[model samples]
Target chain A: MYQTNQLADATINKSESAVDVQPDLNQYLMAVASHQDKAAFAKLFAFFAPKIKAFGLKQFRQEALAMDLVQETMSLVWRKAQLYSPEKGKASTWVFTIMRNYSFDMLRKIQHNKEDNLSDDLWPLYEEAEPEPDYEDDHLMREQLIQGLEALPPKQKEVVEAIYLKEMTHQELAEHLGVPLGTIKSRLRLGLEKLKEKMELHND
Target chain B: MIKHHPESTMIHAFVAGELPASLSIAVSAHLELCPHCKAIADKATKAMADEFSGNEALVELAEPTPAQPVDEFATMLAAITEQPTDAPALKSAAVESSNQMALGEKTYTLPRALRQFSQTKWSGLGNIQRARLGLDEGDVHASLLQIDADSAIPHHTHKGYELTLLLDGCFEDESGRYEKGDFIILNGEHHHSPYTAEGCLCYTVSNAPLHFTSGVSKLLNPIGRFLY
Candidate 1:
């Protein structure tokens, strides 16, 4: 079971048809977001409610709780549709995140008898991941990093070298250099600022 | 270096939202500090989404009839559309506050998962201080544990499972040194005294209390519930 799940995780949905499905859903979601288009929302609800219910049933194993999960999650989708951005992820992923969160909170309520809604606190729906750069931008950044490394002062350069080049964690580097962790952090901060400046300067 | 991590199966379960909050928060805190684990979590989440997307055929089999009929869907949509969307309450990611804890003169930045219990007070004995998170996980307990510099925790083993994610500084046990972002899960078979040179803060969750193993520390076994 574990091996299958791990294998499934490794093989992401890369098919063209699978890729094609996301944009259409994104459009429907956008329609719902821009205008309170009930038709667009209805489409989403029709598509997602069963899946959410299916997921909830697997997790909760009780019929009423599963139904409640569907209601709560769909209602949330209706309300929070505007927050969805294609840059963040596909529409299905967004809905899955919401469904799983509700499922988690419901379990907490039932098992622990804790009424506090801690799901959002643990996994903030609005929080976005750091924007990923495409391959070209990555190459450009590497070039800038080399130039940036050259421009750094000896002390700051060593910290950046150890961190980015050698992939040494701040704690490890501190221990390696026999310096306080605070000293390593300060050097890293300064070094990072210089690197960012170099990148921005190259861009300009 | 982060030598220890939660198992891959654990990460999958975490992404699937199968773990209890007590255990989930420990993973969340570790993910905040470990980019490697974060990448794995992101992939798992994506795969979960794909699974849901692809399960339309299976969903039909599992769910023979629509739970909510087409007509009721319209009603729910109308009701939902009528409601005002809530603005996000906490901009936790961008708006940083003093979500930190002090162990003596030095303060360490608490992870986002722990920010909720930032105000909890600390109680201590000797070179150790602990703040319970008040998570209602039955037998399970979650806490922020602080070890003062040049101090050693009594040699002990877990009764069930103990998951400790180092939030700051470093500590070494008989097995190895654990630094920030290390996710170390110890079972009953493992027994060691953790000592730190610069002191450290950790988010620890355990299903059962510690069993002090040796000498004078064995006296602490009776009060282990309070200490763990």
Candidate 2:
């Protein structure tokens, strides 16, 4: 009973009023990183925990494991908050990267019991070599991304959601959606191109 | 210059954590050297985050079951917040030394992603040398393969899938010539003999043994199982 239409409508509304609420996220992260502010941490948890749980459920498809992912991801966020650099990317993108990496690590561990060899030190952490374009406009990027998602045609949005949120392979997505593989690929390519264009326009 | 790069779909797969661990490592190494792919990957990740947030209300809440489970969340929170006793050592080690491995008189710097496995020793086979990278235990095999200049690998097809990331120099095969930072992925359907003119180093990951397709090199087919 996931309401795709309602979710899209809510996101579209959120995008319209995003400017007032966006800066606070980056500020809260900075507060937690600089002072270990419990109040800020709680605020971050309240905002991200449920979203991460949704992400985990989408990935693991098990409530228990998804909860574990939320716990692990938030805990890492608390410990590594100092590593957050405003110069690199947006607060949401940084948190998303951590959650994604943690989810991948957990999935890998479950599939194979080689935990001893697959230590955290061995995994390549996200390290960008070049300075990201429009780093200072991270909030703008986040707002534009939501607006862009709202702008996609229904079919394109579905394709993008299956690939990004559900982590579905093209073959799997094609089978699930009852579409030809070529159609799925084209939808996804078109969706991403539109998103890129929207973000670029916002940067200017 | 990198003449070839990983396709956008592959990068999306990598970002989504759908790729196998070995292939993920190879792509990570390639990303370190290829900025174009890196930029695309960054955008893909941001888009994914935004998409997830868009569907925020749909995520179900975890309900506590009455089984007397330890408060895992509390335990995790405490574990992460606690300062590690080895913090100093970890801090010093964080500044990774430039890792360079030498083959004969030629030396090449390893990509940051591959530097962690530099301690493993390289084993030689004819003009080719390889070092198996131990990544916990899994069916997928990953290694560094270095072929001397003008050397040719026996013509072969993969049993499963093979992903190669050129770390240095150049090589030519049926597809095209691959330069540094090139990502080459092959499957059971492909058959090619790769030869390098200026020598080449690659990070390769394979799920199954390569089946030799041609001449006297076919005699080494049985050994190909262990070669990768």
Candidate 3:
């Protein structure tokens, strides 16, 4: 479970699909933005909608709400695609940010509709800044990062994924994993440091 | 220059949209003031996006739902493609108003992100003046605090965590001098009295009440409950 260098090599050698799809994803987003390309939109919808639905299900624990999140997120992506630029970030990053924002909005709306005493003025004030380009070709960087994650010690990987992907609080994650809170923090810190080092080394 | 900033972990949570709404707003305000943190946030966001898009297994698991009707897809496609109108003008108006927050004789130009919430009435608490921002519906409390020049807050420590964003003037505590746009976070381990030479205004959020730690101010611990 703790194998590091070997696992990194193995995962990188095996997972070629991860490296292949990102440029095409970027192109699809650009086509949708430049022209109202229905074919491009359909392709994006086919790829991202289900994954977004899975995300919503994990967060909300309700199938109907998850489906709604998928629809709302995809619709926003369509309307806002023109704002996307490869110079700023990858298409997936842009879409993921939109989905995350939409999820919060939907949650807030539900909470507001349920309680009369709560203030109705609950909208967040800040708009998301455009993503900064960290790598000239983000797809290659992503492939390396995925390989890095695969290389992490299992415990560290679990903690990193829970915090970054599942949105769990440190305390909650500790409880969920039945580990000491300090252990969770250390694991997360170490995992992130290693991942950052790997990405930086790859870029250099 | 900003002497303080939210930690990288906090910024990661903010970019991932994992923070609660009140904390998110406070971090957002800080982002507008601190370019250093904003650049870090952008990088974190890009990395998360790359990781998300690279997950071929997750994408593959989501086989196209056969149940989604063709007409529904068509309707959604049409809705998304509709041309937006006059949005830029409306956005500029909003941005223009957010720059000025009026209280008494002074008008503070706030960051654009904080301009949307309408201000509530400020209530005087000794030398400190405070107004609650009704921007979130939860247990986490957020407010604007104004301390008069040459005044000091009683020494205190937080029960959970307190995040304060300095919006105007400067204040000093045992930790260091905090100027406009400094983002400070204090936890249970910290105990300091904050003082200002020039009266300061700040946006603050706390998960729990602050516990007053010194002198006659201990009597006002109950009042500190309402202040946070």
Candidate 4:
């Protein structure tokens, strides 16, 4: 937790060895809420900042701007700890909402034009396809999601698995199901929505 | 009478962000001319990102308590809320079906107070039975009619408020094409025939009884009155 000139200078390069806290991000967020824990905040800052940066660069196309957005997003998260209703959404969802909400605002201000911040060393998120799913620890989550899907009504689950998991084209799915294309699509939308509600409840 | 035509399939693709640049351009142009589609597209755009890859989400490493996380969420939410507040979130995630689908833009989220139905033990009615979120059940009971795409609604009139939220797909009325997330509020004065283009899942919450357009629809009267 030491922050001096040397530590500040080397932290980024040494981040490779930064303790990975992928296991208890939600707990960490709760800790921040329980006690104004600066350490926990810093840990979160180090972890999410990079991801936020990548997302921002996608929207703004500038490293500095992305970084600024990250800083702002994290700062907001820090301030909104009281509103962290785990019952409503997962920690990740809350965090993502912050970024998405901010970007939406930024998009509005920029009017869909690319932000020309002219910074070096950054990459757009979408262009660099997301990393392949790592099953190492996320298996529980994946299973939980699958189980949740099973718990949905038969029709709803069918639409969700087909559209979201299998990525079946609507027409293919419609023809295959012998239902109208519109019915398939609407069912898919409704099914996922139901699943999201269930998942949020399970996590809560 | 809308300036742009709806393409349910393209909208589905656009929502998934899988449509080609050319298709996207056309969809985007259509969205500019159409607000309903814009609304559905907006939710689907975000939902798609959330579904495929939750990269944007932050894993909960530790819990923040008492904490005093920053209060920035409110301001940002306020800002978002301020951005035209015309768009409504989908009740259940709305499916885009085809990439060319165009959605509606005036959905209003029902308040928790209004959502009083048990998730368990719900029934269907005439292929569109609702689970009664306790919500507009009274009203919904009166006018809840869901039509598959390309199917025709009885083309009825209303006695009071007819608020229709296109949960998925769309139907055409004299006013125009109504798509997912689009809200159509009709009063007793308005009368139109609503037909699903191909297949649409519409959630029409109405407080008033639907007076059928034709005398033949009057046959629906004896039974339909009890329906409401």
Candidate 5:
């Protein structure tokens, strides 16, 4: 169960065509983590370029800002690849983190210019893992994670989905749910804590 | 351990990037060794990742579009290498404040730094040794009151108002348990038979000394007046 989810960090879309050129996801990550592997780099670029662009477009609300964020996020991946721990998170989450950080930078920039602090209420800043210069495994420990999430109660699932997927902070989720900030946090904590208990057994 | 506080909204500050860096790293190290925290983190992170992926459709259908690449961002990859590790910086001498060690709690700290007058002044009271810290602050007048955690201060109420933020362990009165980071607000209407559980340390700020409702203990009110 754990081995399967391990591959999650790779950009290999379970639905998309499998990336064939590499020995495995981990190996591929380590090999091209440095700027030297242009072939691997090109492959990665093809995978993330559009995702980054789309990611930025959502946040900046302008084509140019989105492109800049995309470019910056990818470039950051290029440098930090060595720091990416295959054990920490999936590839998509990592890249998402970079874009998220870029968004935060934009928020700070907005604040510096005396603009409204919209990001002020946003919590849960997810970070991207850098490209790993060394990944020894091809498998991922994700099945446990997936199964755990599937087991959550509907309301808990909804809360998790809204806050995490929608990028709404706890405060934002609270406003949307018409609940107290404490209630939102309690839901998040309780939901995740239950999932964690189930996952620990599966991972073990 | 299930911390059953009615208000124990313990979000992984680590996940939120809001925790101090060293603490976050410490938690990460623990995650690698203890599947407990890791699985917890994994569930949160994976759920979050899935949520974001699903939202891709909604975002694509909207908007005037984002800006193009800027020179600062273009150089981001290179910049990541030069940036320092996201580790929290721990100063050499972190515990210099007037926080005193309560006897029964085994150990308690004076807050780190800001107490520069050689040593704290410990005055003896019944069954407990009290310490006076001249460390003053805004609305809350700061002082270090160390009582044997096992011993209870005689019943007392405030003349003004008082605020206490717990720093070490739990302290319980008629109100409830106060763990670390617990900020307790008490006014003249409040009276507590406060005692530390297994002994604890509390950083207290009071605008005035406490006034006893009824007791020969009311005699302390005169001194509490000058102290407050």
Candidate 6:
């Protein structure tokens, strides 16, 4: 069992209200992970491909590169789905991480003109699955994280993603989101604080 | 205990895959030895996932535009699914690499991130030995630096960002003592002479050469180009 702070509860309730309006992505991912179900994978593709393209367009601003990102990212998701653990985290995170890392390596290749692939060695996809004695405790942390994600308001969540997932600067995010720079900064700070608190709770 | 770690912002950049290869390698090595920072990274990863999920609903809301080319994606999906799963260089590659480095009688197992780099043969200059890790990160240079027992480096400052991650043994400078797994970053501002009592092996990455601040050590500045 984990302790749920007030903010966490509030956010969970808000997302719960919105839950019926959205598909359960985790279920779709689990189907792909356990059964190699192509239908579930297709659903995932339909959901994430456009988002990845949008991210690529935002970053690369080139249609060819954006299309390449979509293809490569979805391909990776298909190959590595079996390695993902729902007890450890959400499917969206696992897929997003793969996309983010692949884009990072692709950008480096284009910028540095290097052929070597360094992302795998730097951030191994199977690192979390390495056998550890405290494997059971990770489930509790996962529970806490599921609740913590709900706790964060949608606006703050968007701000956090823009900064961490998109690697956007405050000014870039302000312009991209069409909000004031000060609001972006404040949301980021608040979101990071909440994230830190959640981590501390897990550590305890 | 590890006394020094990468700054939070750097760790966040690392998690976001924003850092260059050289810096990413150094931070990855440090995270292997420090669990405290790993937790923070994991938390940030979870947050990114949550934020990523938020987009699913938003993308759906903007539907009826018929802009998402479903036919092209279906083609891609069919091409991907038809291929056998045991395709790319995915799993089992991590098991083959030997992660050990030797300097005279001492042998140290390097962090996994550093193991991917094939190190050059160790060459010595006075009491210090350096082995370069050939990573392509523009102006950045990555090396495995080993100082013999009771050896001291000359007082120096960095021209650009310098990252030194202690892999084994212990060392101290003007600032404080560093044990195994300490991640120390120095720039143009700080100047320090580091000495080790027990000999230490460090993974260092820097974009520029060290500038020797002292009199006789200034001659070694020319050698810094080769070392950095």
- Candidate 4 chain B: worst-modelled 10 consecutive residues by lDDT: B111-120
- Candidate 6 or 2, higher lDDT: 6
Docking quality band of candidate 6, CAPRI definitions: incorrect
Cα-based lDDT at residue A112, candidate 4:
27
Ordering by lDDT: 1, 6, 2, 3, 4, 5
DockQ of 5: 0.07
Give the runs in model 5 whose Cα sits over 4 Å from its true position: A1-27, A60-65, A105-204, B1-38, B51-167, B173-228
- Model 5 residue B29 distance off true place after TM-score fit, in angstroms: 13
**lDDT tens digits by residue: candidate 1, B108-144:** 7777777778888899888888999888777888998
**Residue lDDT tens for model 4, B1-228:** 233344566576654434322223334434543555655655565465454224333332344456667444333333432323111232112221122222232232221112111122334445343332222222344222345445665778888766565544567888877655454567888988787766654434555566786868677766555334
The C-alpha RMSD in Å for every predicted model, in order, reads 13.0, 12.8, 14.0, 19.4, 15.2, 11.7
Candidate 2: tens digits of C-alpha lDDT, residues B114-152: 766767788898989899987644668998898999999
Model-by-model lDDT, in order? 0.76, 0.72, 0.71, 0.51, 0.50, 0.75
**Which scores higher on lDDT, 3 or 6?**
6
| Highest-lDDT candidate | 1
TM-scores for all predictions: 0.74, 0.69, 0.68, 0.32, 0.38, 0.74
Which window of 10 residues has the lowest lDDT sum in candidate 3 chain A? A116-125
Give me the runs in candidate 1 sitting further than 4 Å from their true place.
A1-20, A128-204, B55-70, B87-98, B102-104
The worst-scoring run of ten residues by lDDT in candidate 1 chain B lies at B55-64
Q: lDDT tens digits, residues B113-174, model 5?
A: 21232255666566455555443223445554555557666578887766665555576788
Docking class of 2: incorrect
TM-score of candidate 2 relative to the true fold: 0.69
Question: Residue by residue across A114-197, what tens digits does model 5's lDDT show?
Answer: 232222112222223211222113324555665677789877876776666445556545644668988888788888889889
- Model 1 / residue B22 / CA error / Å: 1.0
lDDT comparing candidate 5 with the true structure: 0.50
What CA RMSD would candidate 2 show? 12.8
